[model samples]
Target: MNDTLHVVEKLTEWRARALEFEREIQKAVLGQARVIRLVTICIFARGHVLIEGDVGVGKTTLLRSASRALGGDFARVEGTVDM
Candidate 1:
């Protein structure tokens, strides 16, 4: 019983932190609520995310903003294939 209570408490705390993180990211990346929400979900789930979009679609901006908000490291790589 005690262990279950502890787990529940930790989950609640983690949820609060995730919400706070979403708000922080929203400040920088406007007009992308869905993207922000998805990123936040990924953070809480401890999952990786792959963002693909055309150039100038705020992809890098979104990732960078999320990293800053979550206080985590951000690394990006750009690649192109030649025919």
Candidate 2:
């Protein structure tokens, strides 16, 4: 049906855009293809992500790069959980 075909076409276009977005983020955050792919999937799925790692691991850079690719602003908020 024409409607089904249209849906498929839209999905293909979205997929391409998502891939391109991922590539853009990857360009800024190097040596983390797996992390980039997972973040991209979560981003396109409209989900929130909390990245945790040791200090100086480029987490902020990854997030900033993703925000840039999304044409959005990045704000860093440091959090702590006091036991």
By lDDT, who's the top model here? Answer: 2
Residue pairs in candidate 2 whose N, alpha carbon or C atoms collide under 3 angstroms: none
- Over all chains combined, what TM-score does candidate 1 have? 0.80
How accurate locally, in lDDT, is each candidate? 0.88, 0.92
Candidate 2 residue lDDT tens string, 1-83: 99999999999999999899989988888899999988988998899888999999999999999999999999988787862
lDDT of 1 at 34: 91
Q: List where candidate 2 sits over 4 angstroms from the true fold.
A: 81-83
Q: Candidate 1's residue-wise lDDT over 1-83, tens digit each?
A: 99999999999998899888888988888899898889889877989998888889899999999988877889988666852
Most TM-score-accurate candidate: 2
TM-score versus the correct structure, for each prediction = 0.80, 0.89
